[model samples]
Target: MKNLVYIAFLLTFTFGFSQKKTESLKIQNNENAKVHFSDGPALFFTNSDSLILQVHPQAMLIDSLWMNKLIKSPLYDKEQYMLGDDEILVAGLEELPTDLLKARLKYLNSKTPFKIEYNPQLEQVIRTYLQKRKSSLSTIMERARYFFPMFEEHLAKYNIPMELKYLAVIESALNPNARSRVGATGLWQFMYQTGKYYDLEVSSYIDERSDPYRATEAACMYLESLYKMYGDWSMALAAYNSGPGNVSKAIRRSGGSTNYWNIRKYLPNETAAYVPAFYATLYIFEYAKEHNIKSKERAISYYATDTVQVKRQLTFAQINETLNVDIEVLKFLNPQYKLEIIPYIKNKNYILTLPIKDIGNFVSNERLIYAYADLEDTKVEKPLLELIKLDDKITHKVKRGEYLGKIAAKHGVAESNLKKWNNLKSTKLQVGQKLVVYPKNTNPIVTAKVTPIKEDKDETTYYIVKLGDSLWSIAKKFTNVSVQNIKEWNNIWSVNSLKPGIKLKILNLLNDQKK
Candidate 1:
């Protein structure tokens, strides 16, 4: 009886320890599964039953399987103690093979989210997102580090939700120069008309839609207005994605379903996906550390900068010379100024962002800098008007069955000149190629004699046929001539079928000798 009791106690203790170990493994696996770090590759673990690792700063649990892999992989070296995978485990970060860690990160970053069970519709959408995400993540991570701080600052100033930062990630992946197929542009993806409504200047010289600071402020104001109308964050976000009109229509269709999910079915396809994508992105970013994704620290300079008001036109090149700074740095600071020319009209202040340290240097040498910039602008005078005039030349749309030579002859210009003006390398002319026929006068003036043709009152009016002309063209030669005229007068409409040297009748004839 004593032996049996002792055996029972031992079994119970073993079972309890086994349960605890399984529970620990589950927790670690969950932590390893999450995606983290906007810039680094995603990290994940395969075998949750092996070892345990923890994230620093937060001390989140990491799965042992991943830890073991990291330690054992080629990424880790056994000797000379590098920060490789082998040393990572030896460094007491985890008790698993370091080889697993390397594999886990690769898997996590590359893995697509689990597909919805028995739902083909949702699976298709998920697949598309995963495919697009593969290429997009790298670009987004690169640009986000530089832009996020400015975005956060602006959002905070407006008392807006910081989560709004994800909107840019969805809109253009933080690419300020992004232009959509439909012409929507910038990091926030504002259309031209909408951008103009928000006071974002759009011109040949500059597109303020690409200006990170200006566009963010505009987006915030627009979002604020939407929030005021909808009274719901989700609805406001939907309205922003698919316009307020569509959201209102959806609401009305759903019998006033204020919930996003309730009205999601009635929303536009992309808008429905937009909200989910936003939520997924927010979740991924929030839980990145758990996934073992390490962010590469980049010390961005110029965070502490002051904007100086300048009221004169200044080029970045000029600024570089005058301020003794790299032109590239100025470009990084002022991306809004396309052509690198600051339009500083008199009394209209252009805010120039400069490093705080350089503010003193600028103030002391303001006059000299201004003078130097003015001189540079004058010396490097661009023939902007001439370029515009050239662009404004008349265009001739090519018609069907017409070649370049025919069109050139019709417009009284050489084929080569037309090609040169239109930047065509070949003689091929498509049906709608807008061939430039007229160019600005760039030739010396020449005098020529003017002779007038003499009109014959009773003479036979005959039309001279030129190359590529046919007799059928004679019937349609005169505005009032009928097809029967060619068959009646010349007794041949078929023969008039567009042959060279085919003459047709006209009302009267004019002789140059008589004039």
Candidate 2:
């Protein structure tokens, strides 16, 4: 009886500790946190609406507002969403009948070994496709009109099911230039090493994975190989998402079961979502009309375009100006042109696909187009060092007691962005580590410019310096405060003299902050 009571007491203690840990996670705090997020900072983007700065999300409606602001921010143009990131950001949909879905999936089933099953998670993803993310899906549908035909042609060569093309839909959403956090690229989302194994080249100006035709062929081959190895297309689909090695690991954990659903519990988080997303996408694509979803009309399609060989190196701007074609349209059609330039080589031919209507003019005016170089960009030479020294970047060295959130707040950037740039998995920090900050395009880059601290009629406040607080860092908290000013006001000469809890007088800070 005494032993039972002791065990019960221990269980109660562990459960209470777990509750406390979970509570600490739900509330925002800076100590040893995985994700260092802060609230109520100045604007991060320059061209964004002021409401973005005012928006806060603990409330229900404000949650969507915060996500909308992020999509508009400059970071949206730079940062590519990986699997986990998409699951969070992609919007949701209302629930549908499970029986209807199973019937539809079973009806659409073909040569591919697809398993039509329903779970709450998969249902949620189906909702995301049919309801919440309707606009995004509509846009993707338009792009599919241009890309899907090409994918079908290539995939047919290998005799892989047409359904497998939807895997690319889940991989990159049909964006040929899409790049993942783990360095996957192209419509197929091939990583650097995998792309190389398939003979895709990567250079400063050329990444073959961004080429629609070549990468699609490579993806088909990879999928075929995966299907051969697994024999079951469902497992192959899972294996394709996570490497075969991961599928093997999942198989081992599931006691030699080859079924995806059976071994799904042992698979990686992203791969688990990946298989369902692919099937859910297939369902939506087939029954979109029933769901009242309509594909948006695309400005261009493959049937209306023609490919031509370029003998000379040319920029998209030159082509756009010479042919009177939209530069954005050129970019969309030819995503492999990384720097907006289609490079030519002595031994190899480079092809450019253009609208069929413009091909005749392009052939006639080839000589004039070659000579129409925009020399304005050539006058100034780009320095090697200048690559890192951008107007939008800020360099900061970590100090004691400084974590991700504090630095992000000071510089007006997101902590998640910081983690992305630095490839950090956690919010843990080390003293004296240098961090590079990239602010939103709409926000001014915060630099180390010291201004004169204004006085509020001889009023003063005392600050108890924290562990990582230097004169420079403390000064940043107040406008127009500087390291030199702190020394002058406190009569301190050595920076090393600062210790935690040491009170320092800051002049006119309280009232000066109002202005």
Candidate 3:
């Protein structure tokens, strides 16, 4: 029954007014295309020459039916959100006076290129956000610290309005992995087609639309194109919500009107409410402090993260286990890896983003890390394609000087696997020892020599364990040292034994060599 009433009201708003063609308002192309509002107690609608509407704050306070209408808007709709998702919706906000709202909006209008005017519908939208979505908004605001700098950088690069950052809040609640019912995805809510149009690749292993930096850059380019098409940010936003074709159709249906408000009712329901939600979000974020919308604690900033080109296919689990990084943090940083696996396809460069502190550790122990990942992959029930490509297997004849570690490094296979495959219990090798190997290089044979690790069991060293230290990390520090070897040598059977200040025995492989 309430939905019927809402529909009736929307229809009345859509078709009640007589058609009057007015010249389309074009925002000038300048650094600051500010739109100043006229001062008065009586607020004027855009089409004031034909109709006059007065602000009735006291009457609005008592109008239950009108308030119900406001509640029905998308701004108050929380049906689509999931818990722990970035979309913030606040409640229990104090009532904002009409005059104050007008003043704030006037200031906003003076600062932005978009037409931010005082209308009952817009007022309802803004008030809904302020009154009902406070906590969520605060959370989103806090979360913005992680992403907004990257957003601003890309927006500035494309000369896009920085306020458009709020569009992501409206679209995906700032969640990069957010996907809509209609299949629009990421922080920018791009559809498969639109994402592809902007060079956001979606493959079996990756979805670039969920990558914050890539998606933001694509969104800026897309929005810049939309603005050029319409010469107005409002319409561009509308077109982005729906499409240019829908906006064009709405324009035609509204007797050739170009104003968003004038043709809004002709647009799709979601698109009709889309721009208002954006504007409301913009207003809320801009005056967050004034309204006491305090931001929650922010996570790691985007600048604190860096990406490195992945040389081998690796799972988030492998990375987490190897690097002692939290799995959730890996997912958050590298959301584009669809299967949580970064693929190493030929000629295609895929990257893994990590907190800046992890980059050096990852790079320094990359070869061993890849070896560990390869060993780990062998245990999976259904291993990734790159792992068990039988076609890439090759044979290598072990020379007199060759050992398991040396051959493994040359072929990019795990040293542990060499022992398993050849049924060798020891590191001893014989001349002309034929070994089956799967080289990552995929060349029929690999002759590239790897600098061998000097094996010296005579010299022993003790390593005091540090906080957050794992066997994998500790093993990476020593040449030719495996976690299995560490366990056997130190008689440490479980990870619990790796308490801080505990000293673990290590063989100083290069003790006799000069630095």
- Predicted structure with the largest lDDT when compared to the true one: 3
Clashes of 2: 6
> Model 3: per-residue lDDT, tens digit, 368-422?
4675666545433332324334666778998866666567766655554565566
Residue-by-residue lDDT tens digits, candidate 1, 349-373 = 5677765534545665465456444
lDDT of 2 by residue, 467-509 (tens): 3344533654555454445665764533334556889887764
Against the hidden reference, what TM-scores do the models get?
Answer: 0.48, 0.57, 0.61
Winner by lDDT between candidate 2 and candidate 1: 2
* Model 3 weakest 10-residue run by lDDT: 35-44
Candidate 1 residue spans exceeding 4 A from truth: 1-139, 294-302, 357-359, 380-515
Residue 274 alpha-carbon offset, candidate 1, angstroms:
1.2
How many clashing pairs per prediction, in order? 29, 6, 7
Off by over 4 Å in 2: 1-95, 110-112, 118-121, 373-515
Clashing pairs in 3: 88-136, 89-133, 89-136, 90-132, 90-133, 90-134, 91-132
Question: Candidate 2 — worst ten consecutive residues by lDDT sum?
Answer: 48-57
